[model samples]
Target chain A: MSEQQKRTEIGEIGEFGLIDQISSKFTNKNSSTLKGIGDDAAVFGSGDLLQLLSTDMLLEGVHFDLSYMPLQHLGYKAVAVNVSDIAAMNGLPKQITVSLGLSNRFSVEAIEELYKGIQFACEDYSVDLVGGDTTSSPSGLVISVAVIGEVQKEKVVYRKNAKENDIICVTGDLGGAFLGLQVLEREKAVFKENPEMQPDLEKYDFIVKRQLKPSARMDVIHELGDLGLVPTSMIDISDGLASELFHIAKNSEVGVTIYEDKLPIAKMTYDTAVEFNMDPMTCALNGGEDYELLFTIGQNDFEKIKNHADIATIGYVDKRANGLKMVTKNNNTVALQAQGWKHF
Target chain B: MSEQQKRTEIGEIGEFGLIDQISSKFTNKNSSTLKGIGDDAAVFGSGDLLQLLSTDMLLEGVHFDLSYMPLQHLGYKAVAVNVSDIAAMNGLPKQITVSLGLSNRFSVEAIEELYKGIQFACEDYSVDLVGGDTTSSPSGLVISVAVIGEVQKEKVVYRKNAKENDIICVTGDLGGAFLGLQVLEREKAVFKENPEMQPDLEKYDFIVKRQLKPSARMDVIHELGDLGLVPTSMIDISDGLASELFHIAKNSEVGVTIYEDKLPIAKMTYDTAVEFNMDPMTCALNGGEDYELLFTIGQNDFEKIKNHADIATIGYVDKRANGLKMVTKNNNTVALQAQGWKHF
Candidate 1:
């Protein structure tokens, strides 16, 4: 084949594939590096305790739209997403460094508003704002946040530790953030077509807020610690429930079976999806940006969390031969498909 | 004042002023956070050892010109700059997270080339490529790198620890990287005017390579450890010697006096600046991105490194009343001015 033919577009392999291809070439050389890529966060040993590091970058047009998303909420969501990565490792976030690239169009007051949100998130999560680099971008705004957290050696959880029969649990609700985006987009289109039209967004406030500012499930992480329970495997549901479940199954080398009825969706989200002429169950399965915690625990720990109101038992681990499947309320079993957020 | 009149443009306050305004509002709340802003890197305590964290973001048109800079070297420089931050803190970097936002214009082959450079730097610095986020960009490429390092509690250094009698020291020569950029820009302009003209860059290879692949002075950091010496105050010369010295002076609350003749400049850099009709001394003092170490050692401890070939003692700390001055070769004591890289 010619050299030109050998050049594959990044869109061909997708984001996860690109990450795997890149990270696979790098081998960890330091003994302090307890874990590298292929997890929610990298783990490193600093004496007796383990330290977790995770980073997330958001670009203006790709990850968010400034027209509908306020700068403050953007800043808050950036920190919250990174904190969620730490929470996925069952760690407490302590410090964060936020880097930003702004165009000349951004005023000092605009940045202050963004930082106001960042400060609020920092206070909410109790994470200290440490250091970062601020530079000018040629075009749009860019934000990258790196968070460091601490977890005990015995208590640290990874994505590759699930065993057969482990119960799958997800915290809070799902799909609200995705449905929120839909409402915002619809309103934006209407406003764009006719400037005189005022957006009637009061009804979809909850779902819209979920998209604008989704909080990380650090509270659930704290509650698990208080209950003396550690998840066998855990991950944050940023890329929809099916995609995150696929990550756990792929990493732990196990099959998953989730019941459709057990999936948690807020009433507002379901109603909004119906108003948009979308299936609520499909949104729950494939919509992204929920920022919820999806974890698995041994069956013995089930009794301890079963009585909890926010925790829901969605599924259980199975043999790899069974593959990933979901059972509908009508008792029809079908193969689960992961339709994650595709930026490309 | 009206609310609209109160709005301040970022360019008016400049980058440092904006940073000061933002970071000043944040107070570190975590006990583990030893130090926050106003340094090359933030200091934190992780068990018995102290950890350092630093992050840098590079935007496509702002930080580099893809026409001249290879993706591989851009990747290498990104990691090197962050590693320099760790070295400034007297720490050994163990892990780094690199996040990238790419547009569709880049092919998978382009990304592979970039990662190859990242891998090379990882090997060179003995740092593990830990975790990062990859997403699509709407316009150009953006790269953000975060590094974590460790130093003994007693050995960790800060910018505010210089003494009045401390001897100022610098590693390697300065201004090469800056001149190198000038040459590249000239060539780019020439090529744009006439694509048929083959650019001649072989003569400026030394400065060009310096611009493309600047290495962090990790060797000096290791040698300092071997000599059983710790800098009283230290900072990496990323934003020019004058700017960095001002950082030391402001943070340490001390005046600085340096000899103009003592400044180190490579023959190539000096000659290149002369050819460009720029002052060579000015370039040496104000041209940034040297990636060299600027540190202060107490007077009594200077004897150990005074005779070293790579170590140049350019000045000494003085009383605050003296202010920051540079004694020119003509015996004129002039106040030093910091012309740092301005993006806004």
Candidate 2:
């Protein structure tokens, strides 16, 4: 409490380091709190079915830009990302609460448009918009969403449950959302530089939509349910695949060995990354915001999903001493590095 | 869709109007969602025990000034207010998720101080800190909290169940939080005008504490349970007494009548208001952020809490035709007007 007290900058610790520091000081007191700060979603309850809770906050200028991002897409993306967290837990989202802090610059109609998308997502996910608080912000919009989901206790998955020989799989694709962001940024720059010039977005539609209206893989969750498959470990790729792989490795006390040839990247995403003079494979590994499902299934369950079209077997788990590495198409082995999104 | 299109400003409809507009467009698709919107908390689940979910967002500048409001109290208050929403539904809070948007101006220690307050509230309320999202903000701090609680299906209270003859009651005193804010703002102004001037806060400790660290009335909810009585209707007084009374009336389809002399007001709060050249009774009625419980209990349960030390019987519910009126100490009746907080 002194003026010359020790001061540590938040940037020095970064996001994950700060999380570890904060979580270290606290201990869970409730018996029903099955999990707390470490996982994608907090788990609780003693019944055969347990509840999951997760929240995400998006600031207007930091997480989005009104100049290019539509309010409707922003609303939809907000709900979708939270829904993705529930899906990552192998749970079905039942209810969600949205809290918004809006400045007076926003019109009632603008808010209506935002809610229209929220309603669309509510219907799409079959989740109810239960309750929220709307208050005035001093500046930009602040949207925070909290979702409640339920999963059968026997089938619940955590990042720490994967075994040494589990198979790693990713659904849909990766790098598209990140590549989509690059295209949008380029267009925004062009539009800002010359107001009279028309910003051509026709060719970038696929990646643009990937960034703006990315869907949570509730479909994949349902498919997994139908396939009668439960992953030993699961995570949503919101912060790049390599970063999440590190999480799985650290939590599960295992190493990862992925093949570059097997990394899921759409043709459009690859071509766009190439057009931007970026490595396509690097983009797929580090370009986050895909909201794709990344899970590890035991080898015994591999026969069930191997022929599935949307899913790609990307890697296999290894012993903790093996470390995380990738094998290239040329048969060269290299260490995998994670360039995760750094908010700080 | 065009620049010439009609656009209604949010100021025209205010906060409640915006909420009504949003809630009207959405319908519950999940059978587990027993209640959605238009209440202190959303109720879900079909079991003998139902779940409650509620969220609140607090913004810097609009909600608090860091110059006077310590980060610790801000964190405690952020949790307390959300827990108050659960208490309003006569439920016990069990889990909470805190989402914080912070600017780099805050140090790691500053965030730790903030979390310390949150930890204190978690201990006080016996609610587990389940999950949360923390990200960088462009400007000031933003805090959003969502809480999940549980209540017996038969005992859960709602805003729309007050009967004509139910006895309206309030716990603790009112207007103290508002008076505290007045004192703090005055002190801030004084300090700003003359940096050399030391704030004389000793005399205003009680009221000031009320503003900075208001406690949710969970204690009263426990007491009511012990007395084997459940309120027919209830709401937390966050936007002042008169405003909340109107909510109960509109939701329950009943009228409200209260005695002016029966309204609880702390002596210090009354004295501080007088010093500020403000009406003490008006502050108690229209001054917001008190976070006290206002409820209506059946007359048959009157004797159960007749001599309760903290609870004060203010009036009785009335037929809708009677209108909302207050009987003055001078034997004159005046229709109550709600000068609620206008965030816009």
Candidate 3:
């Protein structure tokens, strides 16, 4: 680098812009690569059953605090988060490879506790723990997981497949995980100020668990399969609902019209957000790490999932000109903004 | 975690020991998971074409020094290392997902330079960069890559498949990479002590390049396919010749016997080792990061690869009771110990 050469900070473009720049430079040469770069998982294979590959990396200080998080939940969340990517593709996770970079600060027993959680997740999701590389890190603990999944070729969904007037649906409630993180941070701060503080986490157990060991919405995918319902478009809500809607809208070349009143927030999550003096709706729209499913289905397929207990029909897809907007209880419409979990 | 509990350091078990312990506690539940935990890459898929999944994570301070290693070379090496795992399994890499943790210290242009090397490697090795996650790191740069590969189910090789009397062969020379590291470190120390000193790395270019950006032997894998020869078992030589031999021996339930005279050491590597007062043979046996191929072919297939220039006939498989041993040019035999690249 010469002194005259201009340097651009990564924060200038944000992660999505950087991703787009990187993905645009490469082209797929293999025919088996049905899809790449844009979806939750990369799709490949020539058989009737296609394969899904996705990876996620969590650094110790950046992604987790470890002060309030047990190694067990950290391990479980790492697997679940990768598994959620497969679910977002309407695929069943078959196997995962975990690569860890550990510091000497972690003992053998501590590492075993982490693996125990991974084992539990394997059993719960019916995915096998196959291969991984474990090495030493200079500083914090690092966990990177890559998962393989399988889905019927015809049933596979991408973020770009939504059609106009499609019914938008979300599995389970949102914002709980974000609130859980907030509560954990608050408690950690409290504990730091007073060593005798015991965290008082009993009152916030549900939300804290949501952050620590959020479940991937595999159940919703299986149920959709059983009902013979296929989503036209799908995405995992790791970056909050509003941000994910932009992904679908941009990829599908369609606009979204979600009802703010239709959004589902758990009773506890709603009350907890209020306690923090945060608007529950804002938390639902912008708070992330939910690991829930946000997807769109054709209007005709909505009948099949209409009465489902966990699935909520939030809104409908519209024309690109309409843009992404939400209808509030006061009958006013406003454009949706994504504030998608920017670590940069 | 309890008051009376004992904590064991990970160094006590070492990396292989920790991996074995973790692998023993888990069992494959998915029938699609044909080979898991023990192989170079996890094998799955039910079709005649089997799928291979493998991941490797590299950290900044632990794996390389940016003081000498350019980011471009780092990116190239990261992808190549993962691709090597696929080649070790007798498979061709098709697609890869890279997860990176970057600190603010890097510019967008620096990342682009890094990706330039990755793109070059992708073109060189014929692999696709399908998906990845890039986030802010709290400390040093982190790179984790997972690759997906395909091979004929019957042709896929595992470490446990070598037979008695098999001819052991290695692709290219060994010890160059390890010696390259010694030169770089020595130059770094010299330069650190006196600011005016240049590295004077001109004569050591070949060896230094070997350490900075070693190539994966995918070319050899392709050549084997063209020659209609498949090794009974295979493993990439990332952890030196003797250590990899032990892997092949232990996994195959056999023993190895290699002649010291036949060990292929490049002229440059041998000279560099001598310059550092290190035994060239010891450098070949225990020095790591070579990224070459070590495998065993049935005695009948010797005619197919016997005349190959890049392949060296170094040893042969023996009975398990015989143990891993090396015969010196002086007509003396010694047990080979694997001081596999240990960071712990």
Model 3, runs deviating above 4 Å: A1-4, B1-4
Q: Which tens-of-lDDT digit does each residue in A121-229 have in candidate 1?
A: 9999999999899999988999999999999999999999999999999998888999999999989999999989999889998988889999999999999999999
Report the lDDT of model 2 for residue A100: 92
lDDT by residue (B147-215, candidate 2, tens digit) is: 989899998999999999999999999999999998889989999999999998899999899899989
Question: Candidate 1: where are CA atoms >4 Å away?
Answer: none
Per-residue accuracy of model 2 over A207-319 as CA lDDT, tens digit each:
99989998999999999999999999999999999999999999999999999999989999999998999999999999989999999999999999999999999999999
Candidate 3 C-alpha error for residue B81, in Å: 0.8
How much is the lDDT of residue B78 in candidate 1?
A: 92
Fnat for candidate 3 (0 to 1)? 0.85
TM-score between model 3 and native: 0.99
- Clashing residue pairs in all predictions, respectively, total 0, 0, 0
Candidate 2 runs further than 4 Å off: A1-4, B1-4
- Itemize residue pairs with steric clashes in candidate 2: none
User: Model 3 over residues B240-318: C-alpha lDDT tens digits?
Assistant: 9999999999999999999999999999999999999999999998889999999999999999999999999999999
